[model samples]
Target: MKEILLVLDLDETLLYATTNRLIQKEDFVAGIYYVYVRPDLEYFLSQLAENFKLAIWSSADDVYVEQLVNKIKPSAVNFEFIWGRSRTTKKRMSLTDEYHYVKRLSKVKRKGFLLERTLIIDDTAEKSMLNYGNAIQITEFTGDPHDDELLLLASYLEKLRNVENVRLIDKRYWREQVKSI
Candidate 1:
C-alpha cells in the first residue's frame, strides 16, 4: 500500500455537530445532539485507510474527538491517530488581532510523513493556508444527507494513489469540482 498521509477535520468535514457545548467528561462523551455523520463516511474512511495513512486533526476538544471517533468505531482501528485543539497553534488574526488556533500541518510533518505526499481535508481554507497547496478544502457540511463530498474525494484520491507527489495534481480543479457538486 502507498503511504499518502491524509489529515482530516472532524466538524463540518467528516461529521456535522449541532453545537460545541461540553456535555460530559467521565467517559469522554460530548456533542450528542443533532450530530449527523456524513453519508458514506465509513466506506470512504475504510477505502482511504487502505490507500493512505489516516489521521484526524479537529479543532474540537480532545474528549469530543474521542467520542466522535469512537462512535465511528469503538476500537477506532480506522484512524492512525487523532489530534485535538491541543495539537494546534494559536495565531494572531491580522484583521482583528484576536488569537485563534490553527492546525499547523508542519506539526504533522514532524511525525515522519513527507509534506509532498500529505493532504489536509478541511472545510476552512484559512486553517490550511500555511500549507496552501497541500490542502483539499471542502464545503462546510451542515447535516446534508445528500452530501457526496467524501465519495467524490474517494475517486479523486484513488487517481492520485499512484502519483509520485499529490502536489502535482491541480488543486484548482479539485476546488472547482467539489464546489460544483
Candidate 2:
C-alpha cells in the first residue's frame, strides 16, 4: 500500500494559543502568545510518524507557526512540510461576513501527494470545508489538559494508515469508530 500523508493543523487542534494565560501552566511561549499543548501530543506525533508521512498546515501567521512548531516538534521526527497562513486561501463567509483561512488539499496535490492517500486533521470545519472527503474534524483543543483526543485519534489513525484511499472513509463519525476500537 502507498504511504499516507497526514497533514495536521496547529492551533486549536494540536495546541491552543492566546495572549491571556489559562489557569493551567503554559507549555511554551511563542512570540506574544502563551501556548498550551494538548495532552499526549508528543506520543501522538511519534506514533503517527511511524505509519504516516506528517506535515503541518496552519492558518496562523507564518512566524508564529514556525516558532510553535519548532518548540513542539520532537527531535527525531521530520515533517514533509510546514505551511502557514501564506499558503491558505482566504475567503469571507457569506452569512457572517467574516474572513477565514482555508486549507486546500489541491496545494498538497501540487506537491505530488495523491489526494486519495492524504488526510488533514483539523478542529474547524470551515478550514477544511472545501475538502471534507480528506478531512478528519477533531474537537477544538483550548488548553484542556485533561483532553484525551490525541490519544483516541492516534488509535483511530492507526486503523486508517493502511487504507488505500483515505478520502473514501467516512471520518465524520471517527470518534464513534474509535470508541468501537
Candidate 3:
C-alpha cells in the first residue's frame, strides 16, 4: 500500500480538554482547529498518503469523529476508513481505546508494509505499549490553539516518510538481488 495510516486520538490528544466552562478567552479561544495548528500537519498527512494508506482508527465514538470531520475534514478521506469502538470481550478494557486494536489492525491493514513501518501519534504514553518497538509514540500535544507541538509531531511524522521510502527501496533491491541470484 502506498499510503500511511495516521490514527489520531481526538479528545485530549487532538482537542484539548475543556474545563467546566468554555471561556471565550481560554481553550480554543483563537478558534484554531487542532489539525490546523500543527505545522505541516496537512503536508505531513499528505506525505503519508504518498507512501502508505491513510485511515483513522480512533477509540472515540463515531459521533466525535463526525464532529471532527465536520470541523476539519481530511484531504483524502473515506468514511469507511474511520473505525471506532472495540469489538472485543477483553475484561476491563476501555471502550475509548484503539491503541491495541489499532496495532492488531495495522498489521492486517499494512501486512505488506511491516509493523515497524507503521506509527502512532497519541498523547497517552501507556498506549505506546500497544506495539512496543514497532510503533512510534508521540505524546504531550497541548493542542493549544497554536503551533506548540508542531515541530515535535512533524519530526516524528518525518520518520515515517523515511520508513516508507526505505521500505520501497529495500523491496526494490531485494527483488533485484533475487533476480541476479
Candidate 4:
C-alpha cells in the first residue's frame, strides 16, 4: 500500500495560544500569544512520522505557523509541507454570515497524494468540510496539561496505517472506536 499522508491542523488540534496566561507555564510564546502544546505531542509526531508522511496545514498567519512548527517539530522528523491561511479556500457559511477557511484535499491530491489514502486531523468540522471522508475530528486542545488526546489519536492512527482506503472508515466516532479497541 502507498504511504498515507497525515495532514494536521496547528492551532486547536495540536496546541492552544492565548494572550491571557494560564495557571501553568506555557511551552513557548509566539508573538503576543502564550502557546501551550498538547501533551505527548513529541511522542505522537515521532511515532506517526515512522508510519505516515506528515504535514501541517493551518488557517493562521503563515509566519506564525512556521514559527510554531519550528519550535515543536522534532529534530529528526521532517514535515512534507507546512502551510497556512494562504493555502486555504475561504468560504461563507450557508446559514450564517460566518466565513471559514476550508482545506480542500484536492490541493493535496494535486501534489500527487491519493485522496483515498490521505487523512487530515483537525478540531473544527468546518475547516475540513470539503473533505469529510478524509478527516478525523479531534477534540480541541485548550492548554490542558493532562490532555491525552494525542496519545489516543496515535493509537487510532496506528489502526489506520494499513487501511486500503482510509476514506472508507467512518471516523466520526474515532474516540469511541479507539476506546472499544
Highest lDDT, which number?
4
TM-scores, all models, native as reference? 0.84, 0.97, 0.57, 0.98
> lDDT by residue for model 3 over 1-181, one digit each (tens)?
3445555554455455343333234323213332323334555555456555555555555655565645544567442255554521122347764424332534434445445445555555454344444444444544444543534554445544656433233221222343353
Q: Name the runs in model 4 displaced over 4 angstroms.
A: none
lDDT values for all models: 0.78, 0.93, 0.46, 0.95
Q: What's model 4's TM-score? A: 0.98
Better lDDT candidate (2, 4)? 4
lDDT, candidate 4, 95-165, per-residue tens: 99899999999999999999999999999999999998999999999999999999999999999999999
Ranking by TM-score: 4, 2, 1, 3
Q: Flag regions of model 3 displaced more than 4 Å.
A: 17-19, 22-52, 76-80, 87-103, 106-113, 164-181
Candidate 2 per-residue C-alpha lDDT over 107-176 given as tens digits, one digit per residue, 9 for 90 to 100? 9999999999999999999999999899999999999889999999999999988898887899999999
What's the candidate order when arranged by decreasing lDDT? 4, 2, 1, 3
Clashing pairs in 2: none
Ten contiguous residues minimizing lDDT sum, candidate 3: 166-175
Count of steric clashes across candidates, in order: 0, 0, 7, 0
